[model samples]
Target: MKRFALAAALVVLATVPLWVGSTYYVNIASQILFYAVFALAVNVLAGYAGLVSLGHAGLFGIAAYAAAKIMTSGHGHLAVAAGALAVTLAAAAVFAVLALRGTGLGFVMITVALGQIVWGVAYRWISLTNGDNGITISGRPSPFGLSLASPRGFYWATLAVFLLAVASMAVFVASPFGASVRGTRDQPRRMNALGYHVWMIRFLAFVLSGFWTGVAGLLYLYYNQFVSPQAVTLTASAEALLMVISGGTATLLGPITGAALVVVMKNVASAYIERWNFVLGAIFVAIVVFMPEGLVPGVARLVRRSPLR
Candidate 1:
């Protein structure tokens, strides 16, 4: 049954552009895909490792900015992307080392400070980032002779990447390293006593999280064709975090569901409602109040307890 449901969901996702009947909706779907990836990246640490970070947008923006800077300087699209990922991974390593100095709230605060530093640099680095004007890429990459110039093409490309990322994450979470990370999350002292090297497991998890976040950043840059300090803001990180929490941390589909809700509210709802932010906030509050475990797990729990079941 689960396999059938998964196959059905994939079919629906693959056919979204064909059925949506509008470029705007296709682009929105792309946004949801990349943002869902970002939220999943957050969930890697927050859910699995029990290390909640509030500065992942900084890592996300770093790759976007790196790609933009390289592409604008006449580098090849492939090279620019590779460079962006490399830079993001390096930054993530640094962040992990520093953030791991403290556990729980301390780690969160450290990430916040680190994120602010990135934001300040992006805002003030006018020479490279163009400051408030932002840097815009002139064209999209045509990988393997396939052009992503059209909206449908872009959406397909984004979907492909999203699937690869999801598969990789699924594998990661099922691996021994994933078990170690979860062990560390649930009982660091026990894991440490068992010779698991808790800190190392966490450090690696943080870096892995950064890697996926960087992938999302690269996709965001491609989708928007622009990079700016706005992408690195605290609000962006907070939003991604909210998506993770609202969707149910530790679950594969949770972040994606949350991302869909948040993206729809931000893009579709905002168009029809002037107080969309208020509405989104209210909905988030309701999710917290009613479905404290998150929409996915909460629904699953109810289903399990249902008389019909």
Candidate 2:
């Protein structure tokens, strides 16, 4: 009953742009969806698998570049999207192979290095990425002869993908593979003693996280009609980490809520405050100091106490 109610609420929320009738609202909605997807991808690593990654922007940027390049070459077809997914997953696999060999700070360093390398490639590869100037695909491609350039059109498309991704992640978190990954996270030595390959599990989790991040990147490329090296910078990566942490690291829906709040707050704050980052930092500190488990968990506790659960 609760789940059904939640679904209905989401459907109503998804239709807000139609009622609001404003392009700005539509744009903000699109951004919320995009960042929600990005945050969810980060959740797979930090939430489910207990891995803190600061290089997701690398995967996100690479996938966006792949989509833009393919689209520019008159190949913005569904087939090209599939190819982009493949290439992004392949890059994830490579990163997994290299980073899974280490954990803790070593893993963090590896991801940081990977992000820097990707940023450099995107910036220096002028012919391919147009170097810093970025590439703008003329119009959004239709996956099945359906134009998605309009804000509302893109919003629905992105919402569908976001729903599907969330459902898939929910299923994955309840599956045996997810159980094993969690086990590896909690007690890797015990899992290894039981003959499980801990490193392999972590590597697979990394790849899955990358795949979802890639999908988000694809959506972002079409939504903004632009791709740039700055999108994959270390700051972007850190921002993702902040979202996951602030939202409640292990809660399934926490990152989405966190992303929405952060994005909306930043957008609102920048209009008035010159030092938005400082304000954001203060908010983060307060959240960390007051509600260490994140907003979602704290809200859940309050609801439980109110006889709502």
What is each predicted model's overall lDDT from 0 to 1?
0.94, 0.86
The residue pairs found clashing in candidate 2 are: none
lDDT digits (tens) for residues 1-309 of candidate 2:
989989897978688677868888787877887888889888888887888888889999989999888888887468568978988999999988887777878888888899888999999989888999998977777656556877777788888898888888888889999899889889999999999989889998999999999999988888888999999999999988888888888777888888887887788668899998888899889888878888788777777889655
Best by TM-score: 1
Which stretches of model 2 miss by more than 4 angstroms? 305-309
For 1-309, candidate 1 gives per-residue lDDT tens digits of 989999999999999999999799999999999999999999999999999999999999999999999998899998998999999999999999999999999999999999999999999978877998899998999898879999999989999999998998899889999999999999999888998889899999999999999999999999999988999999999999999999999999899999999999999999999999999999989989989999999899889999996
Enumerate clash totals for all models, in the order shown.
0, 0
- Model 1 scores a C-alpha lDDT of 0.94
| Lowest lDDT block of 10, candidate 2 | 138-147
